[model samples]
Target: MNDCVAWSGGRPVEWLLTNAPVDKHWCTIHATHMTAEEATALAASGAVVGLCPTTEANLGDGLFPFEDYAGAEGNWGVGTDSHVSVSPIAELRLLEYGQRIARQERNIAAGTQDRSTGRALLEHAWAGGSQASGRSTGGLEVGQRADILSLNENHPVLVGRTGDEILDSWIFSGENTPVQNVMVGGKWVIRDGHHEREEEILDNYATVLRRLST
Candidate 1:
């Protein structure tokens, strides 16, 4: 489960395809070297692929075949591996941008007619991430945890945006975080764009960094 940077070439994919326990085990195949056939097979096997675009690019990993992965109807989600980037928005932005650059096309991640690239990416990632974590999350449902985010409507990138366009603007155009509030399990952990324990958390984090540097 959640194998970091599991490159998808050579024998790794084959082994995973043949040996991975069904419905109980999933791999986070980095997929930089993944082939189309391998992707299709992984889709058929119902394995989850973890695409960490920020870390992959920082480490010079090859571009993932995102279009092919989507075409095969593969299960996938974004990750922020290695602490290089922490925001889910940035991870998503880079994921779509990488695909656009490689294919020289706009909205490569849309994958279907009338689908918003941002919304599609968000839903896929949320679903796959929920499955990976074995949680009843990823959507607002009757039994799921009450995890929610409130975007800042007044943010410059969000002006005049609505529906899926809001997600698109936040992912592709916003320079700063647009999440104004966050709640988990019916409790507000973040409000007015500030974490509830920000000051104390930063103080402890700085102490640890100082100790490590010494």
Candidate 2:
């Protein structure tokens, strides 16, 4: 009880599950290092399991019980903790592979009819990411956030792919900067593989990091 209370920031998961503010969206972090019971409890509370794949693998964090979570129809998403890597595909593949290595089972993460583990991984991460971030994104289905990544189809890493294969290649293969463009908040943030404010953004970040170090 104490752990659950403390884990939930003094409020019980039941409270969050029932009385979550309609206006102020909420998401839980560091949902790793939990028991199966705790994981199930969190799923029941409508919290998205925030998976940080690269950091987890780097730090040797054990595999998350994604199978159990998915069995419960739990919401989940990904993050770039430590920023050591930044690609949705790597995140997804690492997540699934972690499960596979643990269970020594294939297709344990498919979750439902007609769902490939790869596709499920991508959909869950992207959609749950937007939900966790209090935004509406993840696809081109209309009326969602304009934040989008345009892949370089001609890139060798992405050549000879379509559908889930494109996503699979993107996640598994070391395809970098093949992202030709990105838009955020209905504006072009990256034009021709460069941030519109690249120089300024980099300058500000450098300034902040240097100041913090001293």
lDDT of each: 0.79, 0.73
lDDT of 1: 0.79
Which 10-residue span in candidate 1 carries the lowest summed lDDT?
1-10
By TM-score, who's the top model here?
1
Residue 76's lDDT within candidate 1 is 82
> In terms of TM-score, how similar is model 2 to the real structure?
0.77
lDDT of 2 at 210: 100
Candidate 1, residues 1-214: lDDT per residue as tens digits?
Answer: 1342355433656556666664435756586676788777877777788888888888887788776777888888777777658878888898888888888887777866588989987988898888777778878889997889999999888889999999988888845878899998889999999999999999999999999999
Candidate 2 vs. truth: CA RMSD?
4.1
Candidate 2: which stretches are off by over 4 Å? 1-25, 111-115, 175-177, 203-214
Model 2, poorest ten-residue lDDT window?
15-24
lDDT of 1 at 84: 58
